[model samples]
Target: MIKAVFFDFYYTLCVWGQSLEPRLRKITERYGFEVDPERYVKARENLYAEASGSDPTTHSLLGTMQEIIGSYCEFIKGLGVQEHVEQIAWELLQSEHSLFAASAATLYDDAIPTLEHLRDAGFKLAIVSNWDTPLDPLTERLGIAHYFDIIVASHDERVKSAKPDPHIFNYTLAKVGVSAEAVVHVGDTYEADIVGARNAGIRSIKIDREG
Candidate 1:
């Protein structure tokens, strides 16, 4: 029996890519740069690729965003004030809704019911995610912070690496005083969440929203 249920934030519990449109528009409008949204997305992919191969010695959301924005800034031939461009990029980079309810996530209709069932069944709840910001602020915004006993993010410093790395999961289990043998993880990414958790000795549930 599982004593605790750990969840991944993006695509597992919440809709991943939910912020893309807003971020694209925000950056385009603020910079007066006509960039293809898809290309902008590719730039983000490049940033992730750059970070993924290296150890988590110094990975951060701002660092990734800076890379992408710097590329864009160069491509645009310095149309607007560098500071203004950076400000827009900064706001877009730090996009997690700090005060919104978890309901904003468009959670699968079954998610809440499942969580409620698990809670009623005496399972401790927690979330371990690959994110730049602290989980507490986002959880507080989502109003579901109360449901979790531990919420760990890459920015937490307790764990520097994101999923696909076991650091955050290991930290969470330690924090909850539970053993990997007694806990399970639920997430959307096969490589990051499924394989990562498995390698860490935690059973994992994959949420394939695309299917």
Candidate 2:
């Protein structure tokens, strides 16, 4: 018997808005640089997979000095901001996220319905995601924050490790006051959510939007 239900954020609950690149370009321009939207979008296209946050440690990697300075070096060069390459690269790197719901994402058509179903069924709801930002603000922005008893992101201070690391799942289980045997997680990533929840003694449902 499931007492609680946890969900992943990206792809599971919402996906990036279609204007992602243009919005990114707009942010870059605001940084005092003239970025060709075409070039900027192209640059981002090349980094899409790496930016997906699929790997357990991808969140940590994005903050590393090497990943920061190196990942967007090509983007900066392509946008003709080589003069401020390092600085601009840092800015763009940061732009990969921030206020996910307000600026960059929209919920799937069924997300609210599913959450509502779980909540109405008397299941405690939560969000357990391998994300860098706090999940509360995003969930709150999407109007689904009220459905969750707790929302945990990898960056949440209470989470000692990201997904695919059982630590986070265990921590969340503790927070929700449920045994792993009585809770289940739903997410889009296999290695991160499924594997992590499994390692934590919880079951999971994987959402494969691509297929």
Candidate 3:
């Protein structure tokens, strides 16, 4: 019997109001750089894939921030904007911080209902996300924080590892006071959430709302 349900944040329970492309475009424009949005998006995806595949536990918050800035600079350089790479990177980072810090995510239509059902059913609930920022306050602003007993993020001080790595899952299990056998994880990312939970010896369900 499953005593707890762990959920992924982005694309599983909630999604960002604005994706990276538009934000990137906005920043580039502010800096007088003309970029191909498609190219920029592809570059970001490639960089993110590489970063996400690595062991996040090896990097601290500052290290991660530096990595992001470097990735942005690489993309900007690819767009022929060689000047002000560091400045642009810093401004872009600040923009991102301000944006997400404002809690610009919206819950799915079924998210609240499902979470409420599970909570009412006496199942312990938690949010396990790979998000770099603090998740508790964002969930709180989304009006669903109270439904979760634990909110764990990859960037959390206690969780230095991201999904697809068992460390984050292990930390969550410890915090939730449940064995992996007693919990089920639901997420949209197969490699991250599904494999991560499996690696942690927990059952998992993949949810692809689009497909």
lDDT of 3 by residue, 1-211 (tens): 8999999887788865545566667877888877776677566656555545655456776776666677767766766677888887676656554232455567789999999999999999999888766777888889999999999987766777888889899998999999999999999766787888999999999897544
On lDDT, the stronger of 1 and 2 is: 2
Candidate 2 Cα errors over 4 Å, as ranges = 19-96, 99-102
TM-scores of the candidates are 0.65, 0.67, 0.70
**For candidate 1, lDDT tens digit of each residue in 19-51?**
545555656676675656556555544543443
Q: By descending lDDT, how would the candidates be arranged?
A: 3, 2, 1
In candidate 1, how many Å is residue 76 off?
18
RMSD of each: 6.1, 6.3, 4.2
Q: Model 2, range 1-211, lDDT digits (tens) per residue?
A: 8899888887688876633455556666766766676776566545543443333344454454465466567656766675767766665545444531347667888999998998998999888876665668777888999999888877766565777888888888889999999998998766777877899999999887544
Task: Show the lowest summed lDDT stretch of 10 residues, model 1.
Answer: 96-105
Number of backbone collisions per candidate, in order? 4, 0, 0
Return the TM-score for candidate 2, rounded to 2 decimals.
0.67
Q: Order of candidates by TM-score, top first?
A: 3, 2, 1
lDDT of 1: 0.66
Question: Would you list the clashing residue pairs of candidate 3?
Answer: none
| Clash pairs for candidate 1 | 99-141, 100-141, 101-142, 102-142
Better of 2 and 3 by lDDT: 3
